[model samples]
Target: MRFGPRLLMALGAAASLLAACDSAPITGRSQMMLVSESEERQMGLQAYQQVLSKEALSHDAQVTALVDKIGRRIAAAAERPPGELWRAPRFRWEFKTVDNKEPNAFCLPGGKVVVYTGILPITRTEAGLAVVVGHEVAHALARHGAERMSDQMVAQVGATAAGVALAATVGGSNRRYVPMMMAALGAGATVGYLLPMSRAQESEADRIGLVLMALAGYDPREAIGVWERMRAANTGKHTAEWLSTHPADSTRLADIRHWLPEAMRYYRPRD
Candidate 1:
């Protein structure tokens, strides 16, 4: 029997999904990863370079050194244990401090980390800095960027399939409705799948970050305080957590508290 377009599209999507199945490090959460690691790293490097070219690097030697120190410690702690299902990528880790006033930080794929100077006040101590660095490092270590790209690929495929199905059903007379249907599908995918996935990844990063900081000899409990300070720092109105990619500050703090005990098991304070 000849396969219809809808049936064929379904099979193709299923096959692609099955072929790209991978797992996140530490958490073992299943991930869709159509992009190869090498490709992802190349993209990350390019993006990192682009950001550096546009932003002013911090000239404060002491603060720069501190970020580098903490980043190195956390990067070391991000290595996977021997025999783990997911092998850690060999990252050419580079940490830079930007002079921007925004309290933001991120670790791109292959361990390119950028920390804005404004976050320093919130991070006050070395341990507190570890909380931020560890979380950012966890994002790279877990390959979240690649997973997100994969999700977008899937979403695009879904939209295309929906378009195909709608075109056939609606015909040219009702063709005007196609764009509306596609828009609705896109929104549904964003709200129903992508947004929730992003929130989950953020929370996962928080949990893994706690463990990394603890393993690096930083007190995991310090994470709670860091987040609390972060919440305090941003006194402006915020978007609802469901619509935002990040968990609400209060939710993030609560999660760190809950994960503290698990992370404490890995804690071995440095003398």
Candidate 2:
């Protein structure tokens, strides 16, 4: 019996996926990572340059210094043991504060961290700032961006193969149904798989971030308050949790509380 083209395509995709499996740091969650670290870092570097070119860097010396200080501590915590979880790759860490008013921050691959000045008001204090920075750093440490890229690639390939198979099965008589089926598949993948995976990664980042902040000698408990403030700030502006990429504020706070006990185990007040 000859194997059909669809079976061959599926088998190839499965093999590729299996070969690209990687485990995230601290959480030990398995991830699909078709993109190489070097490629990820290069993409990050290019994006970083583009962002820096377009966005104005913060001019407030004191605030900038404070962000740099907090970012350094978080980076150190990420590189060191227990938090490292394994012999992690060395990241050439750099932290810069952007002059934007959006309460946002992110850590690109290889540890390029950018904090918006707008988030400073929400972060409130050093420990509070650590909560935000630590969470962003956790995204980099866990390579979530690369995982997302891999997921998109696989989804696209699966969609293409599915479309081909559907077209062949329907031929001209039922060709009209093919596009509808493809759209349904896309929607199903986004709602059933990608969104949920993204939410899980967000929660995982929160947990890992709590540990990082604690290791950096910041009180992990501050994370709850910081998120509470965030909730207050965003008031009535969130999308439904199932449809959104990030968890709802309530779910996020609950997750942070749950992980706080474990994070506190790593805490040692900074002298």
TM-score of each: 0.85, 0.85
Best by lDDT: 2
Residue pairs in collision within model 1: none
RMSD to true structure for each model, in Å: 7.4, 7.7
Error (Å) of candidate 2 at residue 181 is 27
Per-residue lDDT over 189-267 for candidate 1, one digit per residue giving the tens place of the 0 to 100 score: 4666788898899899999888888888999999888889888887786778888778999999888888889899889
Local lDDT at 197 for model 2: 84
Give candidate 2 misplaced runs (Cα > 4 Å): 1-6, 159-192
Q: Give the alpha carbon lDDT tens digit for every residue of 1-271 in model 2.
A: 8998878877765666676789887778999876667766666676677669889999999999998999899888888867337555577888999999999987776688899999988999999999999998898888887777566555665643533442343223332332332232123447766778878888888998998899899999999889999999989797898997789999999889988899999999996
Residue-pair clashes per candidate = 0, 0
TM-score of 1: 0.85
How far off is residue 237 in model 2, in Å? 1.2
